[model samples]
Target: MDKAGSEKSIIALEGWLQTPAGVYMRAWEQSCLDNLTADIFGYNAVQIGMPEIDALAASRMPYKLLADRKPRAAREQQRAVNLTLDYTELPFASQSIDLVVLPHVLEFSTDPHQVLREVERVLIPEGQVIICGFNPASLWGARHVLRRVGGTSFLPRTEELISMPRMKDWLKLLNMGATQSRFGCYAPACRTEKWLHRYAFMDNAGSRWWPYLGGVYVVQAIKRVKGMRLIGPAWSRKTAAAPSAVPATNKRREQQDG
Candidate 1:
């Protein structure tokens, strides 16, 4: 889709997320909470999503909220913390935050690059940004196909389902060097049989063999240092020296020519 169309689609999807299917499709988000909590245990972090996540992080470390809308309950639940702000334009000063957790934000963002740039802007030099995304090449993605063909239509059409490689490229563009990446949710997207679902945990074993096949992928990247400029004089300083004032230069040239 074109840029404008893509933006509209993302906004539409964001609104649809409040629905049941949207909620179901996004259930994988909760699975990453454990990882996020572990990573940001004692840092000034920002939870950019539903308000409930703010409360979830309250007991552990200092965290603020940044969502499109004000979550009244979330605000009331964490009354002591008043750091709520807009995601597009954050209130924090440049390079102020130590950690930023992106739980399914890429999937729903109209402008993923802009969001990532904002993440880069708010992060301190060498700060870390943890991102979670669904793998389009996995069994889970295959299952999504069935849902689409079957007319299940749980959530708005996904704007973009990026693979790990693309995400790595984005990190490079934003100057965030990817330090580590791992996959999760190995279970097949569709459980045609009951046993398949029953043995879903077996997918975890497969991860040992084929880590990329996992339904979800997690990447941790550290902001890289900026490039430096070359410093030197524009012109050579010795070029201006006059050739030992040759008064007989013409005569010497005539003699050599003769």
Candidate 2:
């Protein structure tokens, strides 16, 4: 999508996030991100979108930035160095950022593949990227399908839902390995907070029995650079030669003659 279209969709999403269902989804996403980003050590970390949740708050990175198209609304919701820019055309230098977080950005983008390409460009080799999105294999996803099929839209906008497998493929194409993945928020699609709370038991059950069926998923990927190897110093290799075994037997005889 163009910049104006993307911004409008995000604004609508922010409003929807104020509802009970959206509130529940945000809480689940926050918990997932807290666990995922806790150990992501780096010099610079950037959250590409979703200012409603501070994706880098738990990170210890000295430099953290939040980039989005809507800075005014983001400033109201979060406290960080915010940058207004298009996801497909990031202003940062290549391979400079150590980490990037995209929370529900792919599904809402005009060209999700291009967004991923931009993320790949700015992220340093071996850097980490954490992504959170709606799972197409979950109850919430089923509801979305039903709604769309019935000529209605329940989500913030009419966007494509990229499944986990498809996302893995995209990452693989960029030489980024999927290090870890998590799924949570196992509640049915209920509009009211009370109904959502009533089905809270599904959280525990879904975790143990059907974890992958959760409404949301978080995937952490690390960039892999080819032909990268660590080697010891040349001096160490030169000094590593061993003595000949034949010299030991003549040493005692030579000493006695001396």
User: Candidates' TM-scores?
Assistant: 0.64, 0.88
Reference-based TM-score, model 2: 0.88
Tens-place lDDT per residue, model 1, 5-90, is 75565566656545443343344445555555565544577766544333234226565445543434433323333454555677
lDDT of 2 by residue, 161-254 (tens): 8788889999999999999998888988888999999999999999999988998889999999999889989888656653554587689789
* lDDT against the true structure, each candidate: 0.65, 0.85
Task: Name every residue pair that clashes in candidate 2.
Answer: 1-110
Error of 1 at 202 (Å): 2.5
